[model samples]
Target: MRILIAQINPVVGNLKENKRKILEGIHAARENGCSLAVFPELALTGYPPEDILLLPQFIDEVKKELKEIAGATQGIAAIVGLPRANAKPFGKPLLNSAAVLFEGKILGFQDKTLLPSYDVFDEMRYFDRAEERRVFLLFGKKIAITICEDIWQHAALSKDVSYPLDPVAEYANQNIDLLINLSASPFSQMKAERRIHVVQKAAKTLKVPALLCNQVGGQDSLIFDGYSVVCDAGGRLVRLGNGFQEDYMVWDSEVKADELVAAFDKTEETYKALILGLKDYFGKQGFKKAVIGLSGGIDSALVACIAVEALGKENVLGVSMPSRYSSEGSVKDAVDLAEALGIELRHVPIEEPFQSFLDILSPEFKGKEPDVTEENIQARVRGVILMALSNKLGHIVLSTGNKSELAMGYSTLYGDLCGGLSVINDLTKRQVYQISRWINRERDIIPVSSLEKAPSAELRPNQKDSDSLPDYEIIDTVLEAYVHDHQSPDLIAKNHGYPKELVCDLIRRIHRSEYKRRQSPPGLRVTDRAFSIGRRFPIVQGWV
Candidate 1:
């Protein structure tokens, strides 16, 4: 039997378009004379439907789409993932399922056995754990199917006791010939290698062929990198699919397994993940154009370049929103950078809006002297103009704040924080500078002045980031220890050679800004623990 793994990127909630892709895959598999083809989990409605899963109408739409796909599977047998619902007695409705379709008929169904509820996943909120294991017979082979988290039960260890169930081990004892797992796993650096090791270990121990299919594309902050693989009963890889793209590969059951082909190089994989994330996030949302406030700083310059790369130069609009406090060199640098990227540049001075806001609020601010409040007003004015252009032109605004600023509460809530997406919110200030340098290494897309100039908000007459926060090098180290390493303030201070008081203040700011982050837009998650979805903190709590 020839089995095909269709590693595809489906737009979340775009039922019609997603169905088209699924059909296209089926056609390709049939042309290759494959008996069975498998797609990623939640292929119909996309993965992590989130609150959309709560709507009864949305669930109905998913079921309708599944039927349409089932009808298209005339000669080929396929397994597709979707949400299944049934009426509950004196409780919430049942919403869990997967479909096994062959010759336009539903052969069987498997509800996901495990519901993950931690760190950017809330599957338990909408789905109940399936009580039974499902096994299906196809092409003279007994096959067992499991969802993403189901196979990871062995790796999930508790401090005191072992897990009661091992899905792969149980299926191995049943004389199953093939183990197929579908996943919607998100991307982190080095995650592809870890996934391969796990699958190989499982195949070697079980002595059964294993097929792994994963979803690709960006959904909000999460970007799924599809590196699908097929391993033989001897734990040797037969074929590996492409990473960061939509690909389909067929593995013939008669062919012997071979050595594993190494996945994409590290930098190449990271770059592709960013590009795919940016492309699909905008494409799937029906956005054809994007707008950004180009401040002639490294952050905005890098974002503008990435936007031009993701969306064409014609679709990207770069705006220079200058204020009374803005430096002449910065404006020149912004124009130069836009020209370098061959993107259109527009100048929208914020002096009028800034003064108008001050005039309107002067009465309420009677005796209080101007401070960061004035600075925030300038930033908010720029935000308003960018948002106006975005609304008028039907373009999504991209916020350019990096993780370092976000961690220090150095950004204004509705000012720099206003946008449909935050591209580099997971990247620290140091990483931003490094990536910017990399962008300019081969070609000069970003102007050198932008990199050489001292980083500033340009919100006040002589505002520099150092006025409110420590230098980025020091601040980023503190943040990495606390946020990514989960170190306490005292521990971070001792380890990083920082003053205890400063470390404490930094942690306090991060904790206090939880509310602001909760309201911020979704960003691309490059790190293991990014803000917004992955990191959760209480807004009304006193615990440090």
Candidate 2:
């Protein structure tokens, strides 16, 4: 039997466009003489429509689109996920469901059993869990189907991540030829390996072949990587789809899968995720150009490179807002970067505005010594300049702060934190350097001087990041342990070669910075624990 994996990028609430894409995939599968085509979870209304599920008109449109998609399944059978109204009167109004269409009609519906409730997910508020095990006959084989979280019930990524029920085990008890899951699982560093492992384990435990087809594209901060997979009965991967974009694949039961999926380095995956996230963010919003404040630092340099790559050099505007403390080398680096990338470089000095602000606030701070307040005024001047340029030219400002700075509360609010979207907010200082080196592996796209120089805000005289925080290596290591790895400061200090006092202080800063992060722009997610949606902390907590 030939089963086609239809990995489609669906925009939330675009009913007609989503239906057209679904039909396009099914027709392609039919032309290839495939028996069945599987689409991603929530293929109709798109993934995580949030509160739109509560609208009666939105639910009504979903039903209409479901019928329309079913009518197009004349020559092939297709599985497309949607929201189905619950029949019971006492539960949540909707079921996260999939419409099985074949022979020009809706054949059956499979509701999602396991609804994830943690991290970025709030499905418990919108969807009711399914109560039955569904085994359907498709292409002369008994196949058990599931939605995204149903299969993830086996993977222990979090505490009690699995549901009380087990869909894989239920199918394992019965005689079934194949297990299929439709998903809208998002992308993160090393997530592809995790997904492969879970699918292999489920297929092995159930003693049947398994296939997972995932959604692709970016929605806000969420990015769905379309690296779908097919594992044989022996628990080995046979077919794998492409990453970060839409793809179509066919799996034959009799034929063994090709070689194992190639390992993508962290930098490569991070690069692709950022590009896709930026592209969709711009395209979906009907904006073609982006304006970035390039400071000649690695963070800003990297964001400019990604902007040029995502929106093309002509669409990216690199504006250098130099302050009184700005070094000539730094400003020159920004100009050289723009020249190499073939993008327009506009020079805007914030010296006059900084002086004006200081003159106005001089009497209010007459007795106080010059401190971070004066430095912050300069930073905010640059922020105001960037915003003015964006306002006049209709370009979105791209912030350049990274995870380490964000974690340590080392950045100025309303200054460096100003942007429509943050390009590298999820990446740490060390991660930014790693990807920078990788970008220059073929040639020096990033200037060598920028990479070698000490990182600084350049707001005050000879200000370095090391003045407030530890080394990038130390900060990133301690941060991953506490923030991403979920270890306590004392425990991390004990297990790792770190000082307890330093660890405790850094953890305190992380907690204190929650207010700043809450106000920051949405960032692209590339790690398992991104600051945007994956990590949650109380801003006023003293538990640290």
Candidate 3:
């Protein structure tokens, strides 16, 4: 049997568009002489519809679109993920379900067995668990279908959660010919490799070919990397779809295919993921132009490069807002970088606004010496200038704060943190340098001076980041252990041979900055633990 894996990008809550895409996939399947076409989880209404699933009228519309899609499946069979209303009326209002359509009507539904509730997932709040496992006999082939989290039970990716019942185990000894999964899994650093292990394990256990169709495109902070995969019955990969974009692959069970290698390396994969995320964020939101503050720093330079790549250089505006404390070389670097990218650079001096603020606050601080407050005023002045341009022009601002700065509370709230979206808020300082170097491997698109300079805010004279926080290497290592890995500060200190006092102090700063992050713009999530979406902390907690 030939099966079509349709990896599609669906806008959340756009029912008509999603239905059109599903019908398009179904027609393609029939035209290609394929027996079955599979779509990603929640393909109809889009993944994680969130509160949209709570609307009764939304569910009614979904039923309407689903039936129209079912009508188009005359010559082919299709498995589509959607929200199905619960008839029992005792548990939740809807079931995270997959509709199996064949001929001209609904064949059956395989409800999702496991509903993840941790991290970025809150399916337990909306979806009810499946009542039973099912195996369908189609075209003389017995196929067992599972949702995204159903197959994930085998891998046990999370230590805090475990399911008592295994969905794949229930399909064992059934002599199934194929196992198919519908997934809308989000992208992380190594999540794609981990997903392969899960699929391979399932294929080996069932002794049948396994296939997964995943969602593509970005929705808010989440970027879905659609590397839909297929493995043989012996647990070996035979087909791999495209990453960070929509793709379709037809797999023939009788024919043997060559194994495919991973498409991009770690840094390149991350670069592409950010590009896709930024592109979809603007594309889906009807945003046509972007404006970024170019401070001649690595973080801002990287964000500018990514903005130019996502929204064309013509669509990106780089503004250099230099203050009195800003060095001439830093300003020149910003101009050179903009010239290299072929984008319009606007020079807006913040000295006027900074002096105005200082004059106004002079009486309020008559006896007080110029301190961090004066430095913060410079940042807020720049923030106001950027926001003004953003208001007058139709371009959305892209913030340049990286994860490391945001972690240590080094950023000024309502100042450096001002933007419509945070492009690199999940990437650490080390990652920022790494991706910038990768961008300049062939040529120096980003200025070499910007890459090699000491990291600074430039709000004060000779204000190096090292004066306030640890070295970038040390800060990144400590953050990887404390923030990402959830390791204790003492353990991190012991493992890295760092001072225990310094490690504890850094963790405290992270804890104290919860309120600032809460007000920051939503950033693209390239890592598993991002500040705004996945990781939640109490602003008033005393755990530290």
TM-score leader:
3
Q: Model 1, stretches more than 4 Å misplaced?
A: 86-92, 155-164, 263-268, 359-367
How far out, in Å, is residue 458 in model 2?
A: 0.6
Residues 1-544 of candidate 3 have per-residue lDDT tens digits of 9998999999999999999998899888888889999999999998879998999999999999999999988878999999989988588989999999998899999999999998899998988899998899889999999999899898677665899989999999888899999999999887888888889899988889999899999999999999998999998989988899988789899898887665458898898899999999999889989999999989999999999889999999999999888999899999999999999999999888889888998999999988889998888888888899999998899999999999999989889999999999999999999999999999999999999999988888888998888898998899889878899987999999999999999899999988999999999999988996878889998789
Collision count for each candidate, in order: 0, 1, 0
The alpha-carbon deviation from the true structure for residue 195 of candidate 3, after best TM-score superposition, in angstroms, is: 1.0
Q: List the residue pairs that clash in candidate 1.
A: none
Q: Mind giving the per-residue lDDT tens digits that candidate 2 earns over 1-544?
A: 8988999999998999999999889888988888898999998888879998999999998898888888888878999989989989978999998788898898888898988887778898988989887888887888889898888777555563756677888787789999899999998887888889889988899889999999999999988888998899988888899998889898878776565855878788889899999999899889999999989989999998899889999999998998889999999899989988999999988888888888898899989999999888888888888898889999999989999999998888999899899989999998899999999999988899999999989988888988877998888989999887789877999987888998888888888999999999999888878898867788887587
lDDT of each: 0.83, 0.88, 0.91
**TM-score for each candidate, following the candidate numbering:** 0.92, 0.98, 0.99
Q: Of 2 and 3, which scores higher on lDDT? A: 3
TM-score of 3: 0.99
TM-score ranking of the models: 3, 2, 1
- Model 2 scores a C-alpha lDDT of 0.88
Q: At residue 532, what lDDT does model 3 achieve?
A: 65
Best-fitting candidate, measured by lDDT? 3
